[model samples]
Target chain A: MVLIYIDHSEKEIKKSSHEAISYGAAIAKQLGCSAEALLLGTVNDDLTALGKLGASKVHQLNNESLNNFDAKVHASLIATAATNLNAEVIVFAHNINGKAIAPAVAVKLDAGIVTGACSLPDLQNGFEVTKTVFSGKAFAHIKIETPKKVIAINQNSFGIQNFEASATVVEMTLPIPAASVKVTNVNKIIGEIPLTEANLVVSGGRGLKGPENWGILLDLAKALGAATACSRPVSDSDWRPHHEHVGQTGIQIAPNLYIAIGISGAIQHLAGVNRSKTIVVINKDPEAPFFKAADYGVVGDAFEVVPALTAAISKMKHNE
Target chain B: MNILVCISKTPDTTAKIAFTEGNTKFDENGVQWIINPYDEWYSLVRAIEIKEKDPTTNIHLITVGGPEAEPIIRKALALGGDEAIRVNSNSNDSYVIAQQIAAIAKQGSYDLIMTGKETIDYNSACIGSMLSAILDLPYVSLANHLEVNGNTASVQREIEGGEETNEVILPMIISCQKGMAEQRIPNMRGIMAARTKPLKVVEPLATNAHTSIKEFSLPPSKTGVKLIAPDQMDELVKLLKEEAKVI
Candidate 1:
């Protein structure tokens, strides 16, 4: 059996979990086995609807403590579920939570593990999986020799697919491990589109000149219903919060469309956003390194180009 | 208080990645190695900051690699680590490396252990958590801020859409990122002192790796960019709407 950890937030299941479920289902089909899902905490989303993502059953451990993620506790619970089910392969979405717990669970199960896996395993001769390495600059094919295997699928790498099936939901009562880490507070940025789940992202750099000039970027983001991000130096300079920083040293996102304005596209910054499906760069310098990586380029001053783009997008929306 | 900081040597960020031996091995011929930026800037520097705050604290650096990694360890010592430990092995498997670190950590009984969030080369982000599991201690990943008082530690890490502040007792493992501490450069005096620092080499515990690399490949090169005139805003909008369909 293939077991997938269904990642969720406080209110609902995460968008990346659907992709994990689909990936697991495809692996199950290849192995001629069943695909199941393990959900922790109490989620408001309908568990049965997850079947469309390809899981045949949903194993839920509804505990209040499980809501606030603790890596040790989560690893123990998932390891227990995997052992009980005698699963051959386990899957997780390579998100913040998955990155924290997957390795520990892999240690517990003594399973060969691969994180940041970008493609499915080739089982024709041996079980080999391809994963991104060197911070997304290259790929490496890894062969797993262990009988049990664990994989963390990269976000946005596997597209989610829906199938016609009804999954049976089962409630599990297990001994909850004591959490050594205690949550003192949770400060959240609500209302805006989250960078992790946003399909389109508009990011800026020092080229915006100062924080006061951020209104145009916000206007573009609002008009497109996209998230806002900035380069590392912008965050370091306090022009934006650290959470809005996206680069090798900051949050890594894989949105469908990434629009970079005034950023020079340093290699460090590219390491974080290079996974975006399409890149559009707007900068005054024609020789900016980012242009080399962009799918679409516009050589112009941000002061003039941004307002025009925003107005054009807003007008297009009105026409729609 | 005794703290253990794990570090790794990796190809420089600008190094050209290549393969050898029918694409089955990493080409190390012309690659320049350095202490991974995550390890140097966040993990080790944070440990140094804690030691500087408390005169009673001692910082020890540890890495698992062959002789080629000693220079990297010396660079870390110059940044303010008091001592170094090199586990004699050249394994790329994270599990094996964790087991070795766990053994050393168990013997030392250090108050805290730390490492970078992930190495740039492999980008596993697994060693710290795996060590925590083996040592049966609390673990935290992507710690942006950390404060230690007596036997307790307060850490703040990034979540999906927010920040989660956590408090854990001593004998914990943390993987650090940008906000943990600022990067430090070694001065001439510090660089001279690092030469005399004691670096102990130890044998690794018996272990086996469950995964092996089959080959290395590069991502397909990007197609050259299509430039549009600045005044061609309508044309850009039309392409996005009709061609790319992202909007």
Candidate 2:
């Protein structure tokens, strides 16, 4: 069995899990095995729908301590569940939660692990997976030698495929350990399309001059129904929240379309957004390095160009 | 307080990515190596911050690499650390590196273990959590704000769209990121002091790497940018839809 770890956010299954389930299902099909899912914490999502996504069975482990994110507790339970199900391969969504626990679970199970895998295993000679290395500058094809393996699938790398099947839900009762990490407080951005999962994003930087001038960027994001992001300097100056910062050290987003306004395309900043399908750079400086990586470049003042683009997009949507 | 901070040497941010030897190995020629920024700017700085508050705190640095990594570890010592240790082997596999560091931490019996969220080169973002698990310690990932109160640590970590606070007892591990601490440069005195700091080199434990890189390739470079005038917004939209098909 291929055990896919289903990650849940706010009692809802994360959208990225759909890609993981589909990827795991593909691998299971190659191995002539069943693809099953294992979810921790109480979830509000309909487990039956997961069958359509790929999993044949959804194993749910409900525990209060599991509700909060604890890498130690989660990794141990996942190892146990994988053992209980006699899983040959374990799959995860290479998001924040998946990256945190997958390696630990691998250690527990003595399984070889690969994080940020963009492809399924190629069993031609050995079980090999390709992953992005050096941020996105290069790719490395790695082969796992261990019998039991763990692979974390990148969110946008795999497309989700639906099948005509209903998954059986299984209630798992494991010896849940007490979590040592105490929850002190909870602070989350409410009701905003998260940049990690956003299909489109409009980002700004210090080139915006000041925080007050951010209305132009926000208006464009709203027009496209896209998530808003910023460069490190803007967030460091407290002009934007830290969570909005997208760079090598900040949030790593791979939105389908990314629009950068007034942000210099520094190597560090590019490391995070280089995975985007299409990059549109709006900067007055033609010499900016970001232009070289951009698919489309507008060498004009963002203040003049962004508003016009937003209006055009709004108008186009209205007409459609 | 005894704090063990794990660091790695990586190519400078602007280093050109290339491969040699039939695309099996990274070409290190002319590539400037520096201590990973997240390790130097965040994890090590935060450890120094804790030491400055209570002068008795001991900050020890460790790295899993060959002698080539000594300079990077020494540079980290200049920033702030009591001593350093270098595992006398070079391996890029995350598990092997974690096992080597875990051995040191077990003997050191440190109260707090720190590491950057991920190295800029490989970006595995798994070593800290892996080490924590191997040592049976509580772990927190991507901690931005941390405060130590005796035996307990209050940490605020970055999630997908927000942050959350968690408290853990001593002998725990946490990975640091942007908001954790400000970057610091070593002054003349610190540089001179680092020259004489004790840096012990130990042989790596017998460990097998379960994974090996088969090949390396670079991502396709973007072609000529389609430059459009600012006033020609309509044309750009048409290009985005009809040519790029992003819209």
Indicate which candidate wins on DockQ.
1
Full-model lDDT, candidate 1: 0.92
Residue A158, candidate 2: Cα error in Å is: 1.4
Which candidate gets the maximum TM-score versus the true structure? 1
Candidate with top lDDT is 1
- Interface RMSD after interface superposition, each candidate: 1.1, 1.3
Model 2, runs deviating above 4 Å: none
How many angstroms is the interface RMSD of candidate 1? 1.1
- TM-score on alpha carbons, each prediction: 0.98, 0.97
Candidate 1 error regions (>4 Å)? none
Q: Predicted candidate 2: interface RMSD? A: 1.3
Candidate 2 chain A least-lDDT 10 residues:
A61-70
lDDT of 1 by residue, A73-131 (tens): 89999999999999999999999889999999999999999999999999976799999
